[model samples]
Target chain A: MKKPIRLINLGKTESWKTQAVYHALAEEMTDESPDTIIICQPDSPYLCLGYFQPFDSIFDRKNVELLNLPVYRRRIGGGATYLDENQLFYQFIFHHSRVPVALEKAYKTMLAAPVETLKSCGLDCNLRAVNEIEVNGKRVAGIGGGRINDAAVVVGNFLFDFDFEAMSTVWKAPWPGFRELAKDAVKERVYTLKQCAPNLRMRAVSDKLIELFPKYFNRPIVSGSLSQKEIMASQKTAQVLTDKIFLNDGNTDIPVQPRPLKISADVFIHNKKMFFKNKKINVSFRTDNDVITRVKVEGAVEIEKTIIGITIEEIEHILNSGSSTVLKDN
Target chain B: MSKKDYNFPADLHYDGKNHMWVKKENDNIVLVGIDAIGLDTLGDLAYITLKPEGTIVKKGEPIGTLEAAKMTGDIFAPVSGKISAVNAACVENPGIVNDDHYGKGWMVAIDASDWSTESTALISGEKLQPWIEAETHRMETQGFDA
Candidate 1:
């Protein structure tokens, strides 16, 4: 006997509603409530912070305020992200007993539907690492999962388009050149469905997900609306999501030194401005699994070629030693 | 690590449901932390936050939250009590919990209000080994390595 899962297809919603709907469902879920899958798109843009990611450490508050972007703190763990209408959100809320206890296995199970859906849309994509989905080495989706009370929740999106500039500009860069470096790195590593499958319609993608998810999970789907209690819970959860204190909560005082912007499971951008020979030198580089894969140095061109194949520790040693041999004739 | 290799210290009382261990510091004070099996299943932790000192929490309520890369789970209270102290070091650097889960990773000290009644629900003494064996078996059945 297959258990029936509720399908709540909210076509387009207020920005907060997109996040709050799933959160409310998870918070109020009990053994009696049916497992649910929610698909929705936000009508506007908002900045979402991870559950444990401190706001001050991740975002440029002044720029965020100037842009008038609403900031929300979701209970899921992940890096802070810029969300807008260009992405379709899929949120799954299941009782803890229904999903795999191991986080890795849980992600593989939940992401199977989206991976298959993207493939049907004429894109070659698969789940990478624990949760991210990628096509030809470029990430095509944003994913996050966590436990909220007794409910195990997984949320992700299909990117129709993304504003790389907005994402980079809003981040609190440790160095002046960091934003541009981040933007270029992200643009290189992320992809949109429209860019890959230009002929595919968003509705077709949604319909395919609706049809395929129940089959993948072996659960019959019953299209339904939120119960009155769930509606009230969502309204209240929205207030908590946008609360200033909640946004500012967590360890905000941690110093931002070598802030590494994670581009993928193996790619990270480390930016810092080092002082040597009474001259301030801007340093930006990308690391693939702790080894320097690329290097950009503002003060010395020679150091770039020298440090490309070295580990971060080796470069730090060369830079910190104030070795005139490396910095000479700059 | 295999199920038999995971540590379940003999002195601590374990909450099989939440995978937390409680150590009775005194009659009213009990120190709490997640067990080895729980940490093994969670993977490397990145961040942690606990209820502030002096906050009263009910049994099974969230005392704090722990996050790995993109997955977060709550640390539920093993016994109802007022939080006497929170481990600030663990909050600052959560990796220590991965390194020394039973030692420096201890999450909170609770001034328990209902020790006698709540203590009975916790598994300890002769029952600890059997309960852990069952739990590890259950996790393995759910596609997780012990």
Candidate 2:
């Protein structure tokens, strides 16, 4: 007998609630609680950070605040991403024991529905290695999953449109040509529905997912609403999800490097010189227990004040900000 | 250790069912880790979450989770016991699960309350090689790069 899984469609919600809902379901679901698959879209754009990533290292805090873009940290592990209504989210919560114990097996098994759905659309999308759906060598979706309490939650996006400019603007990439690098990186990796077929409505793609999930998982898909218990739990979880303390958790400043360099644990250095877009930045620095300390920078005086600390994040910030204009004018 | 180019360290006891390994640390403690076949098949581990010390966990219940660049899954406790300690290095740098799974990649250690009875469930020595071979064949059938 196929297990019956509840399907909840939260049409559109404040961005943070999108993450909170699935997290709450994962925490509250039991063997008795109906297995669930949620479909929703964010009402506005928000930056969602990976579980272990530090906020300071991943985002230009000053730029994010200046732009008034809200940020939330999800309990799931992955890199930071910009989320908006242009994408549809599917969140699955199942009893942990019911899922495959092997991580890769679970992904290949659960992600079949979406892969099948994309194929139905006449695109040869493959669930590419390491958590992405690729079509003709370009990524079409981002997938990530992790266990939250007794339930294992897998979350992914069906992208109708992507804002490369907004994405490049928000990510912390401190260096000259970093924004272009960010944009190029996205173009190299991701493909939006608009890029594929502008006429395809997101609703049609979502409907395809709804139609195929039951068939692929060998489960009955029954339409349902959140019980009162889930609503209350989700509301409480949303509060914590939006809290600054939760957002700030695990974030630390990463030291800046102009060029890629490998420093082993055994090697120690007090001074070094590196180039940022061909400009020499002489560095004087010390380390305490491998953490950078007492840093100074000479050359590139236009951005020296912002990068004297010598963290990758700081240099990226200066480089990412208006550094290109400074470089051009210099 | 290098039969068929897959690591099945002879000293470690194998949980053929779950694909985890057990190392008897002392009279009361036993260390748990994912074997090399598991490490290679799962790809690089990006995040590791283990139950905090002093938590009582049952045999077969999940004691932690491992997230890789591609997927995420639970780490089941092989014995019913109290989690005495977890690998801090694995938590901070999860790649060790792939780079050095047997040594620095050990997940957690338990102060077993029922090791004498529970350990009989685990297989060691000649038993592990065959079990690992079976697992590799199973992974190849599933389209993994085993």
Candidate 3:
């Protein structure tokens, strides 16, 4: 028998939408369900950084705090987001069985269904290999997803409205140069559905998701909720993610130090970070060539699990083409 | 120039664990480089560090590592031998990895005479292609980055 499709509605909420969806999907792990969908929105606007990106790269702590919105670093790869109430977010928790696991391929696969849905709305949206969907060269939607154990949830927002200026500028560091390009990259790369379409309503877009998903899916869709167990796990996970350490500067700087021995070289190229700022091994690698064939980590008395043995060939592929995200079997 | 028909170099190979591949140009001859796909996903690398040559290294030794964004992944040796050369071009411009992975992206060369046992672990280009394609698919579902 086809399981009933799990349909949830989160009209408008202030918390991180991605966290909410992830929490919901994590909650459903107790039983294997065919499908579960949670429609939610954040209480206010905030930055959402990709899982692998440093938190500092995308947000300003003081600015965000004053605005009263929280920042969330998700487990999915891709750029961050500035989500607010004007935007309606949707996360459909489907089994990894939803598609074969190829990071790039899976990214493409998850996009097809949504793009098809957008096309049905009379918008000529197409998926770009760069992990974006666009109309007339303007991005209409940004997408990224990964799997944990058995399920994969690709969550995104259908922009009902957004403040482009706010997104374009905020939390910017006082770097010496390249400020303008960075800002432009953010604006050019990101866009809202409403801004791109300028015609579609939030309800219509959400409805399209429900209608089109069933057509291509091979499994049952069942309505479900976040079980208590999942909520507990999510809260714990959230606490760790929200930890102050991760919120500070990436801490990637390797200061000039005396402990690791500042083997100074006349080679000039990498001037961004200095080794041993004050005679201490800061957490940074020293690279003279374009490639890193060795690592010098200071402040670490001992290598806990130093990745010493794996050859560059073995890791090169894993680090470059390979991608991973957290999704539990529900 | 016609691209060097890239292959999983014989001497330098993978244990399929998570390191790099290397090759022997001479008995002690060596060339170090990352497998093709590895370069694809490590976008716009920011930093790298390699051990200097003449260093007597063990089989599973820390050759170096690459960092992108905030996350850093280690680069391991295909075989353990003395360090010969480390690519210095990657110093100022780490983008060579994403731009020219095969030629300019070569990491380090080691003149190791004992890569025979280690060579066994490296995946062959002929064999690696299918495996990587399959692995790529596995990565997406399992939450692995590719």
Which parts of model 3 are misplaced by more than 4 Å?
Answer: A1-14, A20-39, A51-60, A91-104, A145-154, A173-199, A217-219, A253-330, B1-6, B17-34, B37-94, B98-146
Decreasing lDDT order of the candidates: 1, 2, 3
| lDDT per residue (tens digit) for residues B75-134 in model 1 | 999999999999999988888899999999999999999999999999999999889888
Q: What's the C-alpha lDDT at position A225 in model 1?
A: 92
Chain A: TM-score in each model = 0.90, 0.77, 0.65
Candidate 3 residue-wise lDDT, B47-144, digit = tens: 56566667767665556655543223456676777878878786446777657655787777788757666676667657776666555544434432
Better of 1 and 3 by TM-score: 1
Model 1: residues >4 Å from true position, as ranges?
A: A250-259, A279-282, A296-307, A313-330, B1-5, B143-146
Top candidate by lDDT = 1
When candidate 3 is compared with the true two-chain complex, its DockQ is 0.08
The full ranking of all candidates by TM-score, starting with the best, is 1, 2, 3
User: lDDT per residue, candidate 1, A1-330, as tens digits?
Assistant: 667889999988889889999999999888788999999999999999888766777899999998889999899887788999999999999988788777788888888899999888767788888888998768998898998998999999989999888898899876656676678878888898878887777788889998998768877889999889899999999999898877876343222223467776777888766555567787788888899877777767676786688897887677577666333211
Q: Residue A254 deviation, candidate 3, in Å?
A: 11
The share of true interface contacts that also appear in candidate 1 amounts to: 0.56
Candidate 2: list runs displaced more than 4 Å.
A102-105, A250-330, B1-22, B27-30, B35-41, B47-66, B73-93, B107-146
TM-score of each: 0.90, 0.70, 0.56
Predicted model with the maximum DockQ = 1
